[model samples]
Target chain A: MTDKKEVFGMRFGQTAGGCAAAVLVAAMLAACTSSSTSSQSSSTSAPAGSNGTVIKIGVELPLSGGDAANGIPTNNGVLLAVEEANKAGVPGGFTFADDSLDDAVQGAHDPAQGAQNTKNFISDSAVLAMVGPFNSNVAKAEIPLTNDAELAEISPSNTNPGLTLGDDAKKLRTSHPDIDSYFRVCTTDDKQGAAGAQFARKLGFKKVFIVDDNETYGKGLADVFDAAFRKAGGSVLGHEHLTKNQQDFKALLTKAHSLGPDFIYYGGTTVTGGGLLRKQMADAGMGSIPYVGGDGISDDTFLKQAGSMANNSYYTVAAPEASKLASAKGFIAAYKAKFKSDVGPYSANAYTAAKIEIAAILKALQADGNKLPTRAEVRKNVAATKNFVSPIGNVGFDANGDTTAPILSIYKISGGKAQFVDQINLKT
Target chain B: MDIFLQQLVNGLSLGGIYALIALGYTMVYGIIELINFAHGDIYTLGTFVSLAVLLGLGVSGEVHGFTLVWVVLLTIVTAMLLCGIVGVLIERLAYRRLRNAPRLAPLITAIGVSFILENAMQLWRGPTPIAFPAVIPNPSLQFGGVEIAAKQILVVVLAFVMMAGLQLFIYRTKMGKAMRATAQDRDAAQLMGININTTIALTFLIGSALAGAAGFISGVYYQSTWFFNGFEAGLKAFTAAVLGGIGNVAGAMLGGFVIGLVEAFATQFIPQGAQWTNVVVFSVLVLVLVFRPSGLLGEALPEKV
Candidate 1:
């Protein structure tokens, strides 16, 4: 019995040892595969300094879901910018390459997805630079990921004041003061609001009623505009806050009518503010009141839904009119030829973002003659740039990565089209 | 006063549609003693069906002198018929087997079915709301410098017509009497040679059909709808039905209009977030329920013999 027990114990020990060995081998193989994959991609691709070396850039934009109506066109614009950069050729010897991904998953603008997308971009060894995450919410989610990964992120449309300036500006100036990986081409809501106030004054509106959708973006823009309007010698009739998925603005309109404000300033996107307001005001016999709004209302979808009742409303957008830019005509024509659709609100911004990305990669490659710079080095180089001349004029960032340029305009709804009035230069 | 009058007209019209839909809940609850959670989705289905009919016929937004109106009416009838069939089918598929089970079982089944219908709608029609073509002309009548749309009058009249016709059907018609008899005593009706199951099926069909018309009118009036509109509208109507006395048919209609007017009034004076409007409305509901648990017109059914 003792001999038999000894043999059984030995058998059991051998089996256990074999199982452990197999697990160890499996883990090793996984690590090996991951390393091999990265090394393989890195080695197979041409070196940044080599002739014909394709400089891989990451383009992140909402391509399918709620924001797709705006995002897809912006993506097309990035492609045009990349193609132009490739044609222009890097100062050394490099051409632009793009790896685009759809960030239009449900809650795409949520911070979780932003972090996940940033991680995914960073994991791709070829992608040295990234662009996008249109909404400020997305930017908030992504800033940390990009900061840690050291990959540069240039957002074309994130305008929330707090995203750049941490949660509270008083606590610490910006979200990541020491980190220079993040950049934004679009002017902040502060500038847009001031421009809207100026436009309201120019139109001879002495008293303006302000309404916000009570979201971060809407409330922020409303506060900024209210202050500016007051400074511009405008009387505030009333201020109202509304939530999402709300219909029936008759009561608010009635009160505003009683107040007898000459103009209405709605600081919210088209989904929450556009159709209901237009329809309600028209139904209330105030169709020609000349409402003013920010970039959130610049979408054609707003006009389409609001229909003819949306006529005479005004909106403030971040960039100049793409139609009038003589230099942008070629870019626009190329974009349409490629995408088979009109460029959306953020298209020019995305194009500029892509240019910024290419410029950073080229700078990084020049600094390191043999291999491409790490995401961190590229990010640092991107932040160091003092001036860049792209589609939207010179691209330069202040301490907050906000554009140094002061270009905001008021566009009127004429026959269901956004007709440009005059640019409101705040610097003046 | 003029603005109030105009808003009153809008509120009444909006309430009329709600009342029409509320009747469906009231009638279904009257017979089954279970809230038909899926009723709103059925209404949404009706709207989509009508939209499909209009689109299939290539009807444009241009109203060519009642031609579009006739087409829209046809579409509405078709939608109601389709919804009636669906209501009967759902009864057979989901509710029939659970007839003898606990009441909670059927209620849970109805909620599950509601989710399925909503998700299916999201799949069939993309998340974006399709703009329903405006069949009614934008009419503005200036009385004392206040403008009111004729569409408002049309909707309110349509609701009353549906309610009166339904009331007559229940009280005056043989099938209606059969439904009331089944509600009174199912076993006795079954013993008297009236098929209880058939009467229940008919109740669902009629209720769903009325709801279909309500949904169609809402779409036409608002000129837009999302797949999720049914959920919100459904919740509001459920509240309305409860407010009027769940089992009472006329009470449901009264409750719907009251809720609509209250909502319109709340939006006008309450400067709070429009989202808070629901809180205010539901708060009133709680207060009313505290005061009257059996509801405004509800009478307790006689104890079992």
Candidate 2:
């Protein structure tokens, strides 16, 4: 009986110890969660010019992971525009407050987290306008949440054609019900893909190897390019799929080399693929062959990763050269002074996005005599915006909140930097 | 023909390193009958330690170019010794306590230890691939019509030497005899006054030391290393161990060599279109299991009544 009692005592002791350990771990996690979140609370509020009223706006960008290369620049540009807006002052003594989140971490890719992030902004009530959710998938997740809350969101870099146009290939109808709270200052992937295909065909490449990193934007753009390329009487050698985080690509490269295509078209971000593709292509002794990628690989980091072979890669993007846009000179000068980091391929689009949002907000605040404008009113007013001239040129949303058929610029590697080659207007 | 041969030689070189890692898995399972999931991570940890040693010795791409080789060798030795100690410690803390417990207990403990090691590694090294400086610039050796790499030859030679040493020690030494006696019948061997605990620790020490050497070589070859490198490589090595016939020493070496060669050949054969090299490897494994349940060389022991 004493032995049994001692055994029972030891068992109880062990169970209590396990429970204590579990609780300690949970407590540590809770502590970390609280402290990290508190540090982010030091986010700067938009300065109230002469009056004390400021509108705080939240912007989500992927600043760390696969999308970090472009997303960080877009975020920086938005922040720069916000700073400029505060400097100029909103018409009736109003200032813009800014809250930034790094969606580049794991949470950014998850649609559930994107919806939750949108819900968090909606509940804040202080956030009158939102700048982004950089990737198209995140944009898709956030659109409904924003629409439900009647919040206005301007995406600086999302290029999915379906965001504005529904699954059917027709232009978005306001009465069709699906897209009201979403607006993008940037041109969609449909325009960019068609331009890339035309450029590839013009280059006299009859056979092409199409590859994608299997992402929301990468695959969608690849599908567009492939269809257009095929219709142009070009033989698609094959479409190869490479995954993210895979370092070894000798097998894929060797296979790609075997197909003996004149050119390779990659539809993906360059975080993982750039260096591997470059190194492998060089090893396969095909370093001279030209490869074209989308805006995802149009950054300097991608070039750095791709090494010397980056010299042969070209990308198509929406932004025209700063010299080409007469009004963009001042915005460019201010942006360069404000941001110490390298300018992204889509920095102009970001500045334009922030400018449009500030303009709509200012217009709404001016309309009311003594009453403060609610977020819902701001959303309706921003949607109804017309003849709003932005830094990039004339910007006005159609019923679907998309830019009126903008042109895309083809950028080629000239002396290690993406220089303007030509511009194709999708409107034609 | 030259490029094809060159790629083949490169494939062989990588195969040798995989085989060495696979040997570590086979030896540990051969003695204690537990798959040491932490073995590959031990290899990764060994590489990190080697990097610290290289940096500590002032061996960088910028300075004392050839002397870096000596520093790398020193680092490899120190890493192997440290890994050997870690292996023994794991046996004492985890497996030893579960010696008389259910079979599932030790397996679960091994998995738990693997996760603990992986997460701890992530904490130590941030989630980024750090480039390791190459010690030997002249890794190639041209002979007859084939140009063989010194690093590849070194890996294969060292792997065989370790296996031979292990084989001799097991068959000839007093501790080896005791280990075999314990493995064959644990309680009976304990009655005969053999220390089962020491034998188990010795097995882990030797097994982990071999894995440590392979890890150092792997880091040198790949040029980049990450915290998660161990998990993927460990899984491959485990598969190699089982393919060769788990708990069989010779079978492990054979399994490692076969898996390495087949993976290389699969890359050569599989169309670039589908990209099904990994799928092919798993498919081969399934077919092998269906045909030979006891593995290539594994023998089924008769039940004692």
Candidate 3:
């Protein structure tokens, strides 16, 4: 009788064990999020000279893990600018030194670590300015810290608009809302989405349907595209947000097909069903419709996943062709010589940002009567930087701290590769 | 009306794949009474296996005529055999030792095995989606705003044929009787002439082979797959197995079609239907569990104790 009770208890335990199998899937997903490639804080010492006082320029970037490729080159560009500034010499007998911190926690950028990096950069009294934070989410966390410290911060690649625009941005700098301490050399997503809408109108598309990956970046981009596209005299058929990892889009596409939209716009990255959405469009008879997307989908993965159906799909990248820009020739040569690698996508932008920071520091030093000036003086000069000529077109920041010249490059996929199409410069 | 018909076609095709996968879960559970969490990854492994065979044969784009027929059949067979052997090995290595242990022991080990298979595939094939060639020319016939592809019809037909064959194999063969006897009472079957080890291994072999067929079918239909696809597919198949009655093969098939139809109809009827499809399907699951714990077609067998 006791043996029978034990077997029954085991059967009940077996049923509980079945539920644990599902729990185990969730636990394994968390376990797979591993950390690797440690980040190091390396400082470059300026060569000593007559009456050379070492002034520091601090930087924060995701320098290890998966973001290493994106962060290392941008950091190198900043270092290159400091190296040049020191060799050329600064006013007040100042020799520039670099104090860089890595914000990556695990192969990916962590916002908390970025905020901590901002605090560390602020504590260094000799640190004149800050550059970095490759991702937008990281910037949101770091900006408030820099703003409170009256430290000048600049980003080379963050394209999200909420960082520098609107009353929401004003809330970040409550200490001095009127005086913005943050700036970015890259074009914003607002301009990119508008550019997509303008391009759609230029293509003579009368009606379009929009889809987003239901993520912050994708949804924001699509929202702007939806509004701007409607304002551009084009009819929006419908907008739908896709659940992440949802594979089959046949039913959704069939509904879209019935509406008879001439174009489809997907505001998402390759991993978030952008490529698969395009591929499966063929299954539902909407394969012939021209597909448009933002920089999220402008990846090699998109080209590879879409296969033969890749043709006629267009995507917009909110950056100039920096590598191909004639003005970037000198910077490109210096980058290759220094790093023994090709200038990455945003290397020129990083160079321009660093150069602009150096120029601002010199201006502040000249104003401070050749004396060591406060970070506030540097912040003022950087904010007052009007339309100045640099590598990535005109290098100047507007009141909201966006690039004065916002450019969007368009590319089309054909022959299983993305080919460069055109670049549109938004008149802001 | 045409839309209804179109969605029905889509439901049946997608449901067929689910049924194949559910049969695997149900068969393994019927014999050993373990959920076999690694079964989903076996399907994933089968996909990569077929992909390798096709690519090795210098296949790209679309192959036509007799070459297409042989290439697909050969790849599908290879995936099934390899995945079946893998299932058998997993039993012999990981689950066999834990068989006599507590129920939680083998269940956790199955989860561990599932993680290894997923990571192994990710390591070998890279983490991104690999493009499968469109060897199965998907030309749909359209009538009155309703579209149905030849591939969809083929998937449904092939799934039914495999399910029917599995049904016969489980009922008519000498091995089938041994499996049934062992499932009923392992000690009693051992007292007789039934080899319990062989019966359980056969269950895994047959179940895993069906999952392999499902992998091949989805690979050809979707034309692209990733290492992570197994998790999503496995979760849904697990839900279907529970909904049908975990230990019954026919119940799993019936439950699969129900889930598939529910998914398709939700997408068609609901606003932003794609967003709400998963919610509706899982809601059906929650309702079933609350009202009828034994599932739709499951028998309320009396506890021996």
Candidate 4:
């Protein structure tokens, strides 16, 4: 009996050990296979057999996280621009290649990963210009690193004005000093938030309740909107700050409902409980009141997730509607044919940013007598961008690397789609 | 007073969910002494399964009346059955051999199983929170000043029925006696001809079915479900189990209700309480544990010679 028990124990121990080893091996293999496949796809998509020198444009975005809903479409827009540029050829026989990196850590944008990605791009000599680090917080972590390298970084979706101006900008420049290295296609939140407030006032909403996701982008927008709305003679009923990724908002909504506001404004992205908040607000008998948000909540994911509750909600996007732009016709058609999906909120901005970067690179190459210009020369050319017409509109960078488009469009979610409602062109 | 009453209703409905999930943790821990961390993911899987069933039934758009009732009943039954089978499979494949090994081994395996389920769901249905079909109408009824929704009533009533049914099964059946015998003394029960594996598997089945019910009800009530929902809900339910007494079913239920009420009132009254809700909930757990180590209902086990 003792011998039988000993044999049984030994066999069971070996089986368990073997099972664990098998699991480890399987997990490692899955990781390896996934990485290899992604690299293979990126390489296969590049233009083949070009005799020109290969220059890479690194696109950093949260391709796999909660922000992927925004990042993937933005990346596609960048890719489309790169493909168009390569087919048309740059000024100096330079072939543009897109090297996309995911700065998402465990399904959300991580600043550390963004910094590391920037360092990798800065270290690569072939990289001429960079297109994105989608979120403003990610850009905050990456700007100093790119500035140290004097690499020109253009963002397609970052909207926080503090990234380009204000105390945060001062803090960023105090260490790096090369503040002009960063630029974005989207207009700043100061303008967008004011526009949102203006739109609300036009709709005759006197009392508004404000809620923010408590992130850099959300809080800044909420503060600006609160000030602007009050300045426009609208009364602020209440303001609340919610932590990101919170699923429950019933208590907050209940509190807000008691205030009896004419409208509710959410300063947050769709991923971080915006859709849930809207749905719950509707469920709490607040559906008749108008809901307004910034560009963050202007994605299809929000529309689908919010379902019937999405109706009557207003969102502001920094870029004009793509279909309305005559220059965007071909790009939109090609995008639809290739991706089999509607062009998202920031795709036009991304396409515009990529084109501007390519235009600057071409200008630098031409200025350098058909040789690849230094990173500093590229930065100077991008900063000197003037009257560069693209799909979205005229693109130019001000002294502080802010877009000078002066255009913000308001969209209403009607019939489960973002339909263009109005445009406010600020007199700059 | 009306606001307080409304919050109280919300607290009870939310507590019912935590209690259902905590029962899974308490029962499994009672028998195996292993905190089955994967129990939460099983709950998530239960939600996804029900989502798939609803989608497959072509019950999209607005469903109503007897049809809505049948659809919900079908979803609950299907999710419970599927999750029960999944629970048994996980125990047999991943946990059975580790049962006799060191305690740390099964604990680690439980975590591993959790990752596997979470990732599997993430891969199957992308990482985004999918909208759960709102088949049940959520119109509120006002009584005096208190407001109550139909979904909240369903959640609380269904939870209590399942809990009562589980208690009855554990107390009144021959299998329940065998399970009690095994939990009391595994070797002695085996010597007395009770199949140890069967009893353990039954524990997993019942626990997982309760988790499934919780998941289904939550998906309906919240109108959303995601892969990571299990992680937060699991942590809260585990705290509930510990707060009640890890091995006591009734204690787990009471602990869940207390935690829920605490969260609701804290969010309502405390300034910026939404930001500090988790802190307040866990602090209560710590205070409870510090004062009563055996939990509110748990009897201290006699020290072995």
Query: How large a fraction of the reference contact set does each model reproduce?
Result: 0.34, 0.10, 0.37, 0.32
Off by over 4 Å in 1: A1-129, A132-141, A160-162, A168-177, A189-191, A326-351, A354-378, A426-428, B62-69, B271-276, B299-305
lDDT of each residue in B167-258, candidate 3, tens digit only: 78877988887887888888999999888888888888888988888888888888888888888788888888899888777778888888
Q: For candidate 4, write residues A15-67 as lDDT tens digits.
A: 11122234224323333333443334346555666634777788887776445
lDDT for model 4 comes to 0.78
A209-270, model 3: which lDDT tens digit per residue? 88888876678779889999999999998888887677777777877787889899988667
**Number of the top candidate by DockQ?**
3
Writing each residue's lDDT as its tens digit, candidate 2 over B1-305 gives 54356546645555566667877787787777788888888888877777777768776542345566567668789989988998889889988989889989999998888887778878886654555655655345665444565656776677677767877887799988887777778888899999888888998998888878887887666545667778877877787778767766666666666665565566656544234555766677777878998678773121212
Q: Residue A273 deviation, candidate 2, in Å?
A: 5.8
TM-score quality measure for candidate 3: 0.87
Superposed by TM-score, candidate 1 places the C-alpha of residue A31 at a distance from the truth, in angstroms, of 36
Per-residue lDDT, model 3, residue B64, is 84
**Ten consecutive residues with minimal summed lDDT in candidate 1 chain B?**
B296-305
Q: Which residue segments of model 2 deviate by more than 4 Å? A: A1-128, A133-141, A158-176, A187-238, A242-248, A258-277, A280-327, A335-350, A361-388, A393-428, B1-11, B58-69, B138-162, B172-174, B272-274, B299-305
For model 4, the TM-score of its B chain against the native B chain is 0.95
Structure candidate 2, residue pairs in collision? A46-A96, A46-A97, A62-A104
**TM-scores of chain A across candidates:** 0.75, 0.67, 0.85, 0.73
Residue pairs in clash, model 4: A65-A107
Interface RMSD of each: 2.6, 3.9, 1.3, 1.7
Ten-residue stretch with the least lDDT total in model 1 chain A:
A8-17
**CA lDDT of every candidate:** 0.72, 0.67, 0.79, 0.78
